[model samples]
Target: PARRPPPSARRLMAEAGVAAAAIPPSGPGGQIRKEDVVRALEARPPAPAPATAPAPVAPAPQALRAVPEGDRERVVPMTPLRKTVARRLVEAQHTAAILTTFNEVDMTRVLALREQHGERFLARHGVKLGFMSFFVKASVEALRAFPAVNGEIRGESVVYRDRYDIGVAVGGGKGLVVPVVRDADARSFAEIEEAIAGLAKKAKDNRITMEDLAGGTFTISNGGIYGSLLSTPILNPPQSGILGLHKIERRPVVEDGDRIVVRPMMYLALSYDHRLVDGREAVSFLVRVKECIEDPERMLLEV
Candidate 1:
């Protein structure tokens, strides 16, 4: 004869986060996940009783009680788009050889230039002038000089692309998205800003398309929006390099002739696939980028 479970224990345990105390009876096979345990402990429970002489006080109710197999029925369930993301993240971890190089750029020059010119530029062009356009132009120049950063490896083959397609990072409530602006090398700052604005607006509206997410030769993650001082960003799939932009803050520093002065500074991080890039090559490429950005005239001259 099959033994019946203690109905009193089973009924009390089903209420969620119930302590296992005086549970009459229950089923097996359902241990709570650790996250669930932590969540359960966060809520206060009743105070303990005074010391007892000795009664087998039923064990405190469990964080969770398992449902009996006989109680389950076959059912179809919906799936999430997360599996595709998981597979790509796992693949990036396994196959790609990753490396990150760090550098800092004094934003004093760039910020002052923008502050002096941004309002007029915006009014004249009807678009807000932003630093992304400056960095994107600099990165494109570097990518051209060090084509390896823009190239990818396929089964021991070096594939180089002459076109520059830069990905701009945007944030929404859910997570970050990178929308590409193609032929970035050929576009002016105003054009780049227009493209960035449209993509960011679309991302916020949850209306970004698959095409907008494809074929990015390089990625720039502007974590500055969240006020991160510095971070090494992960590579986007099929792209060999990512640039991390951090918050611009004022800090004191020594200038030429050994005088201390406060200046606006921002940290930049370049993370690339080490399998396809060398440290010397990577650092030099970033140095060139920094030079172009700090001295905007070099970018205008296309030097």
Candidate 2:
């Protein structure tokens, strides 16, 4: 009589790298039960033990082989998200036209203005006055002067925006997010601060909505927060230009009439799409913004 395998046979087979077949029992509609299979396998398992073999004698220890110094070591596997990020970053390098330009500015005037007005500005408006407001205001004015710097290539046609929608490059608690301040041109300094502060807070909390992140004509990245003295900021995709703000340090700069004084100086960068914006226009536009920030009255006057 052919016997059935034990219930534990599947477990033993799985461990030994062998397949286990389920055997049906003697009933009309046959079924394998645990009690029958277990009894059969347990009772039949008296196979002869290998006739007591002699223990092998121990050999002497062998010396270890030396490894060459030039062997390249460890390799780690990349996750799916990491692979995708790497591919997209590489793809941008091949297709996009990238260029970086740098300039230094005396932030003495801008900082002074902020210091003089910050407390009162915050007290009245419920938001602190930050450097971004000055840059946003100045950039909007500069874009008006040089519209091409704020333009993008669309199907062989250049599209320029009449109004400004500035993307504020904000820091989350960890990563970075660019939240757009729509119609930045029409807003006042206080309004800009309020909007930027709200977006920045929301971004940190990961509560920034899609509406807060879309539609921007230009971008401003403030690397100064991380103490970066100078850096060429990348253009935020569709936007043609990005202004980088750097840390301010006290440097002896020549003021009016060659008066060398230790003033708060900062490095600024305007990286724009050269294909859409000419060198003269890009540099000139940055210079105009610098001029506006340097002379606060210039912001009030249409210059």
**Native-to-model Cα distance after best TM-score fit, residue 232 in candidate 2, in Å:** 0.8
Please name the candidate that would achieve the greatest lDDT relative to the true structure.
1
Task: Summarize candidate 1's per-residue lDDT along 168-232 as a digit string, tens digits.
Answer: 88984335778899999999999999999999999888777646876799999999989999998
Q: Considering every candidate listed, which one attains the maximal TM-score?
A: 1
In angstroms, the error of model 2 at 108 is 1.7
TM-score each candidate: 0.73, 0.70
- Assess each prediction's global lDDT (C-alpha) against the native: 0.78, 0.76
Model 1 pairs in collision: 9-24, 19-60, 19-61, 20-59, 20-60, 20-61, 20-62, 21-60, 21-61
Error of 2 at 233 (Å): 0.7
The local lDDT score (0 to 100) that residue 270 gets in candidate 2 is: 92
TM-score of 1: 0.73
Model 1 ranges off by over 4 Å = 1-83
